[model samples]
Target: IAEQFVNTDLGGQLGDWLDFMKVMTLSSDRKAAQPDLENQRLAVQVMTIHQSKGLQFPIVILPFLQSGSFPSSLKKHPIINRLPSSWMNWEQDTETTFRDIHNREERRVFYVGVTRAERELYLFGPTSRQSMFTKELESENPQPMEIKTMNEHQDNSLSLSERKQRLLADLNREIAAKQIDNARNILDELEKADRGETADGSTPKSTSREMLHLSATKIETYDTCPLKYRLKHIDNVSERKTRATLEFGSIMHAVLEEFHGLKIAEQTEENLKYLLNKNWREDAFEYRLRGEEFRKQGEEILSDYFRFIQENPPNVLKRESPFSYVMDEINVKISGKIDRIDQDGDTLAIVDYKTSKKKEKAETNLQMALYTEAILRDAVPGVKGNPGKANLHFLRHGDDPLSSHQFSEQNLQDSRIKISKVADGIRSGSFEPDKNEFNCRYCDYKD
Candidate 1:
């Protein structure tokens, strides 16, 4: 592409346009178009699936026609399964009765996408056993013009000419890679200033790392995949982006904290909304519209929580309180924020807000248990020696909350022991990745 630009009659103009595009991409948070594209003829438009709705196009190119890419994965949630009143009049199919709406919705969305193309619809789906879209495209029962991938070479799927072309391309790529490597080696040799004192210069410092503080998230991350933890904590290679889910969680946390921290008289819906507005991070989402949707969800969740608390309040004690406990015996310390702490007479209750429909297991939740350990270790003012109750307030469930299982002093003690062992392993450079295909979707270290 660059070669074509340089070889063109308007070489200087093309080069300037490319340089301007590069500057725009670097200066902006996302990729941006050239300013002069508006003045140019034969304009092309690019947009997301949601943005393409109700708009017709002469030609449409749908790339990455995979299972999740088309309709996305639908999680099993309590509210999502319950159908609304409008679907009652439709034929009572298996999808309407059982858990098949996920697939049905996927097909419907794809149909809408295809219908938008009046003349041509190009579906570029890769051939994979796991991709349901690709399998259907490969089948005979097809009205859509399925453009078979030109890269198909296995099992005599390609013509002789195509195979020859592919082989030539591969050979050329190999040669180019070798030439680049040789050039780099030559440049490195030329750049070398010192030939060394005797033989092979001074040896580099020994590669050894030190262990730092440990937390529940750290332990859980390490347990999930050691490579993931090392990539995040050690290498600092994160897939950080404007994430809607993470941003929503943070927004809800702030709203809840403000709701509980204020006095009972001041704890109004308006006041809570004010706190949400104050803490609303618009830049944390890829799109401003998505951030608005998250705001709406947060508002509803907060309203439900505020109403529930008014009816069933538990003498709100603390909100968004930071706590740290040192274990010199294990040479480790745990630090975390307690979402909420409730006082029930002499006993105190630990509460954590969960955004997802799924609940964190009590046995594995080192957060509250670790907090309880601090109270047990020393004489806390409000809390008794034993924590009376622990609750997981799942926000997605509306008013419903999942009660935590019974946790004991032994649980807390053993948790510390586990942390100590993990810390020691980390110090000794024990980083073994737990390879599970199930987690590759979420693992940043996989690629």
Candidate 2:
């Protein structure tokens, strides 16, 4: 059956073979392609780590092990660093819960790879590489096999001792050259400074001061990439023109706010559409075709939104109507726009609206949570006998449906704790940029 399979047209098929003999024959073809395996070898299967999770291999060659490689140093930092203390704690707890799930999956893949080897298993990688698995191996086993270059593995390869000597000589030569160049540059710079040449031919005493009000966004940006934050916030680089999505969001926000402000009886689909047209910029639509698409999406969203509001208007008691409110300021120099402030008797509620895609796990966003804390402590006066509740309403992306989360006192306190830590980090200039692969993939600064 194996001989017939190898010679027949059926052997050139894709996918798994169910027949026992066919499976064994196919596996042999894969092994033959591998360098270490010759006769009786099977087909070589190549796949990414993610794809290879369930599969096992006789040999695994993980090349290019470096500081920024596997078990990446980037994973040390958390993604939601600027989260409010309460939310931060909650997120951390949730993260811990999920961490085990991820670790188990990783372990399963590793186990699959290890168990795959039948007769021989070879794990080859760079000698100078630093990976989590590599580190673990080094810790468990004091001695590790030295990695050799292709030339070193050749028939006429140099001895290990000779290779070391050659490498050392090359390093020494490079170091000597670098030292000489540095000494020459320093000497030239000192001579110029002594002769009043102003080093780079610029006045040294012409320093200027620029006020930079650091917000949560700015802090997060600085943490992601200091150079980016400096270029944008410090140097005041002009941002790219707003995209269609953002423009549409702004238009929707404005129209929605206006619609809510109107008398309940006065609300009409035709009037709302008219308001949308009036507010919409002629050039808002980048293209005529996009404009039509935008109109269609807008109409659907507005219709749904109108129906939602009509069905469920603000549920305040008749006596609780016209909730008078005043914005409080925190002396901490932190400033944020409170979207809507409503009062119910002695209690005040801070409401913020977010229009984003619905997340499966919608924990309180740290920034907004911090804002709530600020309002409770700095903005709302406990001494004046008027303390308010904080609520966040996230409107589903491209829809009118809302999901809300209320903040407790504990949540506010947690926000304060996270904020204090962030503030300390900022003051101490310890905000380090984290290069998380997930964030790097989408980050504007990533190159």
lDDT of 1 by residue, 175-263 (tens): 55677665554444323312111123331232233426877888878877766776666544544333468768987887788777787
* Candidate 1 lDDT trough over 10 residues, lowest sum: 190-199
Output the number of the TM-score-best candidate.
1
Q: Model 2: residues >4 Å from true position, as ranges?
A: 1-216, 219-228, 238-242, 315-331, 343-346, 358-362, 377-391, 397-400
What RMSD does each model have against the real structure? 16.3, 24.9
Worst 10 residues of 2 by lDDT: 317-326
Query: TM-score per candidate, in order?
Result: 0.53, 0.44
Instruction: Give Cα distance to truth, residue 83, candidate 2, Å.
Output: 66
Error of 1 at 394 (Å): 1.3
Residue 68, candidate 1: how far off, in angstroms? Answer: 37
